[model samples]
Target: MKRNLLFSCLIIVCSSVQAIPISLEYQGFYQRLKQVNKGHYSQVELVFSVPNKEKCRIQSGNISTEKESFPLIITKEQRLFLPFDEKLKSDRALINLDIQGETKHCNIAMQVRAKQTKMEYTHGDIVEIQAEMNAMLSEMQGFPMRYFTTDIAGVSFLFEADSDVTVNIDGVVQSVSGKLRLSRAQILTLTNLKLSLKPKVISPWTNGD
Candidate 1:
């Protein structure tokens, strides 16, 4: 009887440990970075692809580097954003997500490779930038999407978009890719620089059905 009881307990523990949640894949990018009064702030957009038809409620999340961990704030729409220290020491970070209905944690390894360019104030340059930003905003409005922002110095803007955008940085043409969503602060940041907007396009596939 004692042996049987021990075997039963071991089986239960093994089964619980093996019952991990389905892994979710996500693509993240830096949308923008700007200089503030005392320091600089940045924003990153993460697009998550939930497995099967499972719904994800982001109970909590964090970004971990080699030295420190930064907590992330998630909006009702599932967008995540956070601020980091001035000396961002790593290009690679680990994202840990604590969601409901999972015994084990769901994690993703993401590459922080989004385009970053300084703003130019030339009349023609500003006009072109404004037009592009406006078009992106108009397209993303009213879509069920997530948004996040971070206030960290020295980290460049990166993001993953549904489509690709062409940008010229110091005379070099480059492409930025990701699904775009703009926070009110992000919109204001662009407006203050006189270069307004970003992108998002809604599709039936996004519903996760």
Candidate 2:
């Protein structure tokens, strides 16, 4: 992922923004470093001290400039991998973390990777898109968060977040990908209808299907 992924997290909200408690340790020594990209640039090896005594690392480098554009690789166990750009390409990017009300902004120097172009998707018609998505999720139970569907005709969803989700468009299902996202109001409405799933001690090892 591009280093700007972390930078994009720095959105400027008019109102106070709350911050997530993502523990970032700035005092640890990196344990390893290697070049994983095809290009040549400086690389940094990041090391972390996990609560369980387990360690993880993320390999990062740059292309031509000294700036590193790769986002920190975060393991599933909550270890934050931070990279320092040796060239310092961009020093003006600000990151804003909004959680409940408190907001904070910091200037972090970084670099971005070059963009590779491929065939793009033209904005599809919204009315038809909604119809297709509702039909696909018609039999789906529980509050759907976000998932991919390669069964649609020819349509493929890039990255579907908690918002910016409508219905699905059908055509060639070859590599068609789709995602399902619900809104706050929609969740509340689903709850009012007595269709909410209470949280439980679900085990990841067991499949609930």
Candidate 3:
């Protein structure tokens, strides 16, 4: 019978060539440490979810850490930036995704925190005269003056000065100097400072055991 229809068409072409046209999922990854000008910059953010409708194309990725091995540049709106090193001592990382041709692997875990603040001044060049005497004594003592503040990951100043205040280190300046002793209308404040990134675990990439 045509040799059993040519052995059932070679078992349906080897089961559609072992089927696996893309179905990788591990949609999470993050790491960011910033403190520029004084030098310190690190960033890593990768997310994937290609449920496979057929259009697959993301042909490169890698970010193994235990010493170093970062190389993942894919942007044109595809998004996946990972090459801004310096400040990743280790919090666990091992991601590799090369979609389309197949090659997925992940095991990420990071929860680092380093939002610093240190102040001390007696005359570090008078720190802009104690930030203009703490914004004119916080608008004539009406309050709402943390000696200068702004969010979105930048700008914070509270001075009383004794040292370490030269200014213009850029990276959105976050200076806090103190020797504690003001009277040009005294005003100094700091509350709820912040910076964060948490991605406990996102392991999911298996197909070949």
Q: What lDDT score belongs to each candidate, Candidate 1 first?
A: 0.32, 0.25, 0.29
Ranking by lDDT: 1, 3, 2
After superposition, which runs of candidate 2 have C-alpha atoms over 4 Å from their true positions? 1-23, 26-34, 37-83, 86-117, 120-175, 179-209
Model 3 Cα lDDT, one tens digit per residue, 106-146: 11212111222333323332333334323322232222212
Judging by TM-score, tell me the better candidate of 1 and 3: 1
Ranking by TM-score: 1, 2, 3
Better model by TM-score: candidate 2 vs candidate 3: 2
lDDT by residue (68-128, candidate 1, tens digit) is 7777676664554544333332345555555554432222211122223333334343333
TM-score, cand. 2 vs. native: 0.19
User: Candidate 1 versus the native: TM-score?
Assistant: 0.29
| Positional deviation of residue 167's Cα in model 3 after best superposition, in angstroms | 43
Query: Which of the numbered candidates is closest to the native, going by highest TM-score?
Result: 1
Worst 10 residues of 2 by lDDT: 200-209
Q: Which candidate wins on lDDT?
A: 1
lDDT for model 3 comes to 0.29
After superposition, candidate 1 runs with Cα above 4 Å error: 1-28, 31-54, 82-91, 101-130, 134-209
Write out the backbone clash pairs for model 3: 119-176, 119-178, 120-162, 120-178, 121-161, 121-162, 121-178, 122-161, 122-162
